[model samples]
Target chain A: MTSTTLTPSFDEQYVATRKVATVGRVEISDVTKSYGANTVLRDVSLTIEPGQVVALIGPSGSGKSTLLRAINHLETVDRGSITVDGRYIGYERKGDTLHELREAEILRRRTQVGLVFQNFNLFPHLTAIENIIEAPVAHKRLTRDDARALAEGLLARVGLADKADHYPRQLSGGQQQRVAIARALALSPKVLLFDEPTSALDPELVGEVLDVIRGLARDGTTLVIVTHEIGFAREVADRIVFLDHGEIVEQGTPGQVLRNARHRRTRDFLAKVL
Target chain B: MSRIVAPRSETTAHAAGAATPATDADATTDDTTSASSATADAVAKSGPAGGRLDAGLRVVPVKHWGRWVLSAIVAFVILQFLWSLATNPQWQWDVFAEYFFAPSVINGLWLTLGLTVVAGVAGFVLGAVLAVFRLSKSPLLGAAAWWYIWFFRSVPLVVQILVWYNLGYLYPTLGLGTPFTTDFWIVEFPTTTLISAFAAAAIGLSLHQAAYSAEIIRAGILSVDQGQLEAAGALGLPRSIRFFRITLPQAARAIVPNAFNEIIGLVKGTSVVFIVALPELFYTVQVIYNRNQRVIPLLLVAVVWYALITTVLSIAQYYVERRYARGSVRELPPTPVQRARRWGAEQWNRLGDAHTAAAPPPPAQPEPVVTAAAAASDQYRTGGAA
Candidate 1:
């Protein structure tokens, strides 16, 4: 459980000799997922450019989270494929057959993509700075010193500079969520995904988390946010996609989707929440 | 469902204007058919006698007779056992004192401790690998772990030890190399010359311990929240990284408690090595008793040593469990040292209480009283006040 002891030897070499990696555009095509007879997602397809921000909004169980998960290869598709930066995710396409990627390849690819979750999912045992540097130093092979500096910069970015030594349990919900953001940003991933980042926070604590995501959006980080906050989405997202019954109900600019949605389901859902 | 039924009962209770809070809770759980029937029976008896009295001035000082009776019985039994042990002549207290720290007995105790630690560590390491194999994605790996656990756990340790001791008879020579190949890189040795009785016993003990440890570790791994694995996956960490970094640390919270349980079991389990003629504590005590015929005292030596070891291990288990319980629970419970300190202070205060009896009690503070109607309303809203 002592993370400092588990830092791999390659960390120094990878950080000292390598250049920063870039994240690529994401492509998810005709992806479908199911558990037993219950279909979670059905033939979903979407494309996000390198620096574009897209917000996915939906009612509970509408498959928005599943679609976001499929993009990062967390949940594999039963049919069709997804690619990031022109390379197939989780699998390699050779001729007509597809072969799953090896563990090393998958890890190397993960450095450019990061995920932040509703519960923060920060390693409760580690301090804030340690949590931020864990993946970078352990998997990405960033040297200990370099990872520390990067983590410190990220803590400052998230307005948690004084909380580097605090454990997740010691931090408030908003602070923990901000620390999670810092951890995700540690690797300078090109794409960042948030799944209901503020849903676990109290009403008053929700604004701080939204502000951090707003900061990321202003910096042009390619983000796919699955959220229930209609107001936050309209303010931060360039495009909003409404999902219902495992399908996209409507997708357009904030003005078009939020104010002038043509779909009946979208309007009904908007009416209830708004 | 509760929302629909709760209001009807609440209104009826209000109409009676003196209903106890018990019926309010009963109405919420009325969805259970059996419970509703019980509620109906209780409702039928909601007469003036069943009405709730005022809260502020009313004092219901119920005594817990069951707790006191059980505590007294337990205390009497323990005291009687201690009294018997002190007065009994058959115990041979002098002989026990003489043999307790004998060089032979001390060596045997040391051997028992050593064997427990060495075998316990080796077994746990082996079991951890098997556990990971059982949990591995590959079917072949899972099958290998499953079969090993099954075989080891099924066989008796005594039988295993005896079989290993006699293995040399079945196989004259044992070697590590590719079978049927001319290149014998791993040198062959006569099995009788290489395998000793002590080594055989250790192997049997470790293998037996491993089967149990593997299951315990697997249960620990299974206890971790699945969302943790999902989030780590979404972060694009490699399989190994995901496991060592995220999975193992979180799983440690679950693994440490049962793992220590196995270690404590292994400590006493070392006594079974007497079948192999190994000089562990119990075996040494048996050897002494056979020579001197101080039967009860010699057996007491083994019992005392075991009790001491188990007590130490129990304390260790408590602290280890507390260490891993961080973040999972609201707060970690106090350590044994802190609890002992507090107990000592309380006992000291009790002993000195008579000297301070002449001191006047602290001036009575003004009692804040609520209107009976207000208190009744508060209790009514909560269903039942704690």
Candidate 2:
């Protein structure tokens, strides 16, 4: 496979024209999210490029998933501004004035950015094909024939073409996660957010889910993954971000950070994992 | 022999040291041989001869002395009670037989069944409408639904029945047909009115049933997963389709069981129509007993019929509940042994499948078509914004 070299500054350019760009990257400005007295994220800011793969790695309860959820405005931030592509998601700006967007508008914007949960939250009532087709037909207003065609192609892409009629309960955990990925991809999202995609899988099944995600990276679908798989991060991620206590402690090229870290915390974390 | 005695001391010392080791070896060997022989002996003892003896003994029924005695006492007491009731000089089957097949009583039973059917259908429709309205985004509709439930629930069925029966007194003209009284548009309801005892009973029973049915419908709706709603929303499904397709189907599982109970309740509740002289079961029985003065016998006939109908309804309820319970358990159509077997098989199959199935392949082809469509739509929307 030929290596495609992506400029480190590609993300910045995407964010600069985000408001006007047809496909925009996400820009999170000094966003601090807190629930009452407990601050989950404090003065955290990061920019995700349109087609860059950034992996967020941290121990449990480090606010990695929370930050991802906040990107989609699933969890309202106490004090933060998040812009997806160019549209302000959590906080909306109107005529030089900024306000938090209403729930309906937030949900509408969330469709642009699809979230794949660790638990593979496919609607259990829907079959694998239906799960993939639902968002496109409902949100995109695609006709049944068009939606089915698209859904069939997606199921085939996920290597579950034959299992399109199977329910989530009937599929194994790995298959369910793949179907979920297809469902998320059905929206043709600009940025895909994964929250521990393989954490719930058994040791034997985790590889299948990880392989599907690795393929996503190869396909140049901009991804922000919160994962615990050190090997996958090192292998696929262009940049690895180490988070602690809701703050980015260190971040750099996977080799520089994962293999030869300068920070003590990074070293300690790597030492334990290695 | 003299040489053996002379070496005894040296031999004795060597033997003493080796004795413990020898004893250990002997003990192990003895245990193995004993266990082997014991097993052999047990196998022989429990072989064909013992098996025949056991089989023969099994054919002889073993008596449970305690259970037999207890059962006998219960039978004797039940017999005594039956004899006392049967032999009583005042006991009369004539009165029961007369009332059981009375024309009025049979007519009342028919009326009761008809009223229950009407009220059940009407109440269910009204309750469904009220539930949907209560969940509506419109404040006016929600308030209207709430008020309707509150009014019907708070008012007693008897009061509602009486009020409906006496509605003519409130509006003596009993307006009907059309509004204006002109050559082109003229309609009038006679002062005599059309609301009869049956109508009054239906109105009262349906209104009462509606209140309870509303609650049942609401509970059913709430029992559905929030994901179902979210899925519908994400699909951009129209509100009506979403409710009918996703919401209602999921809610049916919860609704059926409660609705069955309500139907049974409505059937029994029809007896309340006796207030307005509706010839329902209870009222018909009352009329018979009042004339003959065989109160107990006439009442017994009503009780027997009610019990029989209730039993039939209860059986129907069981079947309905079973039908809706499908797919709710881990193992569909689960029996205890079947569930255990399924669980074990699932575990075994999962282990096998995990070892055999390869890692899921990545998307081999670029999803350029979908991505292109999204980009086009985005551009179109952006141009529209411009």
On lDDT, the candidate that comes out on top is: 1
TM-score of each: 0.77, 0.65
The DockQ-based CAPRI class assigned to model 1 is: acceptable
Predicted candidate 1: interface RMSD?
2.2
* Candidate 2 lDDT tens digits, B1-386: 33322233232233233535344333333433453434333323343223233211223455899999999999999999999878875657777877787788888888988999999999999999999889889999999999999999999999999988888787655544455642323454543356787888898899888878988999899988875665455433456666775677668788987898888777778989888988888888888778878888888888877887788887877666665554343335655567799999999999989865564534686578766986999999998656
Q: Model 1: per-residue lDDT, tens digit, B275-361?
A: 878899999999999998999999999899988999999888887777776665546777868989999999999878965666654
Q: What do the candidate models score in CA lDDT, each in turn?
A: 0.79, 0.75
Pairs of residues clashing in candidate 1: none
lDDT (Cα, tens digit) per residue for candidate 2, span A1-274: 0111221234344334323223548888888888778778887888877667789988777789889888876666777678887797656788888876665566667777778888886766567887787677766558878999999888777778898988787888988898889888888877888888999888888866776776666566788899888987887777888888888888898989998888898898888877
Give per-candidate clash totals. 0, 5
TM-score of chain A of each: 0.90, 0.89
Give candidate 1 regions above 4 Å deviation.
Answer: A1-24, A33-43, A92-99, B1-73, B177-186, B339-386
For model 1, the local distance difference test gives 0.79
For model 2 the TM-score comes to 0.65
True contacts kept of each: 0.47, 0.09
lDDT per residue, candidate 1, A1-274, as tens digits? Answer: 1212222244233224333324558887787888889888888788887767789998999998888777777777788788888887677889988898896777677667778888988877678898888877777468989999999888887788898988888889999999999888887787898999999999988877877787676566788999989888887777899988888889998899999999999999999999
